[model samples]
Target: MKAADFASASPSAIRAMIGRGEWTGPTPGMAKGHVQANLVILPRDWAYDFLVFAQRNPKPCPILDITEPGDSEPSIVAPGADLRIDLPRYRIWRDGELVEEPTEITSHWRDDLVGFLLGCSFSFEGALLEASVPVRHIECGCNVPMYRTDIACRPAGRLSGPMVVSMRPIPASLVTRAVLATGRFPAVHGAPVHIGDPALIGIEDIARPDFGDAVPINEGDVPVFWACGVTPQAALMASRPPFAITHAPGHMFICDPKDSDYAVF
Candidate 1:
């Protein structure tokens, strides 16, 4: 379905599609206006470290919802829903390596696992689009380009790594307006960290991203970067824990909370 379709779709409708295995791709435009989340399922043994990691890296890892050990249902975000089967797709990791992409993880479920729901950039992108600030990636139908930055996140147990940022080249004039619009929603990977000069952030090739597809960079557009929720996934892969699970790239957990629920003055 198109992104416009999601603008009016209820959170439950979106989840139903995912639950039925009808849609298993990225959730960019799905369930619009509702808050979408990043999934991070880990063993109870690693939960404390990951939680501390999220605490230290709030910008990229804002906590929207979290579930207790062995709990498959996210009571706070989606009541009467099972996280393992509610999302369209999931990535399983063993020893930090991506080993499988499964539609459901009923067999993989372990009794000592905890789940975390992180705020995604989709929330802020919705805010930008509403305010008439253009998001080039969406307009071009390409994946929002992301990169690994030289910027380091504060260390927390086994989750320390460089910050990863997603880029959306905005027209020079709309930069400030875009920042102000997104700043109001700090719960979901808020306003940008850098406004121009990719080199300044140690990104040498803006066209070749470390993650996601590259979108066009118009003549008058300036690259704007925001802390990405995927930073933790990258760290988890690097750290090579015994087991971990996360939403596949753009695939996310659609939440019951509306985008306005996170607006701050």
Candidate 2:
């Protein structure tokens, strides 16, 4: 299905589809208007360090909600929801290496695990759309291109790595509009970190993204990058804690909060 089509679907509808195994992929355009989140599941022992890391690096890891150890229900974002079964897909890590892609991690669930929900770009994308700014990847029906950058997030304990960002190619005329619109949503990664020159942010090839699919960049378009929630996943791998889990790329946890709920102004 095209990314834009999912924009109008209710969060529960989208989650139902994901829960039933009907859909499994990136969620850029899905459940538009509702907040989408980055998931970070870690052992209780390591969660404090990760939480502190998020506190120190708010741009990349805006904490939306944190579930008690072994409790999958995300009360604030999606009441009565099971974190392990709600997201369409999940990535399992062991000693920092991605070892498995599981549709459901019920077997992996442990009482000592903590669930973290982080702000996602999708929340701000709604703002961009409202202002008549085009998000190219959605228009092109693909995942937003993401990359690892040389910009280092402040380290907390073992969690440290270069920031990761998602890019949207905007026409020169609309660049400022896009930036200003997104800037209003600080909880969801406000403002452009790098306006152009992917090389400036350490992205070598626009066509070969570190994560997500590459979309077309028109001749007059400039690539705009935003701090992404995925930065934590990159940080997690670098820290290489004994075990961790995260929502698969493009498969975010849909939330009850509207885009306006996270707006800065």
Candidate number with greatest lDDT: 1
Candidate 2: minimum summed lDDT over ten consecutive residues — where? 24-33
lDDT, model 2, position 136: 89
Q: Name the Cα RMSD for model 1.
A: 1.5
Give a tens-digit lDDT track for model 2, residues 96-201: 8999999989999999999999998878887888999998887877778888899989999878889999999999999999989998987888998899999887
Instruction: Mark the 10 consecutive residues where model 1 has the least summed lDDT.
Output: 1-10
- Top candidate on TM-score is 1
Question: Which regions of candidate 2 fall more than 4 Å away from where they truly are?
Answer: 1-9, 13-29
Q: Give the per-residue lDDT of model 1 (tens digit) for 1-265.
A: 5655676889898888788888877777777778889999999989888889988888998998788899998998889778888888899999998999998788899999899999998889988998899998878877889999999988888778999999999999999999999999988988898999999989999999999899889999999999998898888788988999988877889999988999997
lDDT of 2 at 138: 77
lDDT of 2 at 144: 83
Clashes of 2: 2
Q: In model 1, how many backbone clashes occur?
A: 0
What TM-score, computed on C-alpha atoms, does each candidate reach? 0.95, 0.90
